[model samples]
Target: VLKDDLVYVADLFIGIQIINVSDPNNPTEFLRFGTTGANPRDLCIYESLLYYSTWYGGISVVNISNTLNPVEICHIWLSDRIEGLFVSYPYLYAANLEYSVSVFNITNPSSTYKMTEFHESVLVFDVFVVSNNIYLAGYAHGLSIMTLDKGGDLQEISQHFFPNHHHSLVIDEPYAYVGDKYSGLHVYNINCVANQRISVSLLKAGGFLALAIVLIKLSLKLLPKILEKLSPYKRGYGL
Candidate 1:
């Protein structure tokens, strides 16, 4: 997670490592915070806290107000191993290797509880939230779109099945970008009625190792209005 000039990484081998990226050309390691139970899988930041997932199927919250000396605030374990973690304020969404995407209400870290689990008979590698829609990378099952209702339930909105293995997903306005294991990247027009996909092949050069979608300030400002028009409440809307 990027915070100012520092980037906090949830390293599988070394736990949370802080890197100073103020100098884009030559980045240096700022500090390292070791985690006990299991190796870290993913990281998410909100306010002064940093949330990280573990390979042993657990989540840990750390107080990162002081980068030099970070403290572990709380840690919670789940049933299945978590791969991807996305934090939207009070809600924390986790993608598990064992056929499910779990949602947790993080309003109170000490009293945090699993709100709901969207169980699908497929491996879910990543979970990303845009407005009320939950975009999931369901391995070979492709991208699954669901909506988070007021009752904290995840209801299916749409599904896009592809042959490529969907490993990660991110949405930017009119399009949804999906990272495939075999075939580089896949882009779909979520604004359209049929949701037209515009595949951009990046595997020609080499492997598609990482995917990052950065939204500029202007794009971020326009997102609220755009998402309102494409809200999941509308029937027959394809996303």
Candidate 2:
């Protein structure tokens, strides 16, 4: 029930519903449309359009310029079950349970065309776009970050795994909020390139510790004169 600007939500068992939330407490259910399937899992609203992915139905696009009378504009059939969807500029991306992520060109909303697909072993549960990058959450694969190539092709940038099953992810500013089934909610700081380095460091801390110990051993093997020169003070040991 987000009430800042507009309200967009998927009312499972009912349909994709949008409410006029200008009055917050007095939110009016303005649009209701039955989907081809039962559960409307997730949806996103952009400008005058609404994109939804259902548990059974592939994908649905609706025009909500007139809030009172929203119309179904297009529906794209998927090869497998879909759980989440996101729309950015002229593109739409869907997370499919068939262990893959699908991309579509939505320049012409009425006639969308498949752009590309990436296959994985784990189900893709949710996805979100930030700038030109796509962040995907997989049931077993954790997080996958991808970008669009100059030719509009999908390219994998990086992927990392957490301990629990990844369910959903939301990118806000320089942070990414991940919903892990067993871990509850996890917040990540995405402020700098150092963050990626920190993630890597955390992932291999055991090996790093071993390497530090080995380096200390190697340093101890140095000659007395070399050790003295490497020390902060020449023959003046700190108390």
Model-by-model lDDT, in order? 0.69, 0.64
Q: Give the range where candidate 1 is weakest over 10 consecutive residues by summed lDDT.
A: 230-239
Error of 2 at 142 (Å): 2.0
- Which candidate has the highest lDDT of all? 1
What's the true lDDT of residue 99 in model 1? 90
lDDT of 2 by residue, 1-239 (tens): 23234566677678866678788679887767787666777776666777777765678888878766778889887657887677776888888988888898889888877789888768888887777878887776667778888887788777677654666665664655555554444455555422442132121113334434433443344335222221111000000
Query: Per-residue lDDT tens digits of candidate 1, residues 1-239?
Result: 66778878777788888999899999999999788457777777877778888877588888888989998878887656887788776798888998998898889876667889889878988887877878888777877888888887988777767766777655675666566666555666677423533333332213533322222222344446433332111001011
TM-score of 1: 0.81
TM-score of each: 0.81, 0.75
Model 2: CA > 4 A from native: 1-6, 191-239
Worst 10 residues of 2 by lDDT: 230-239
- The best candidate in terms of TM-score: 1
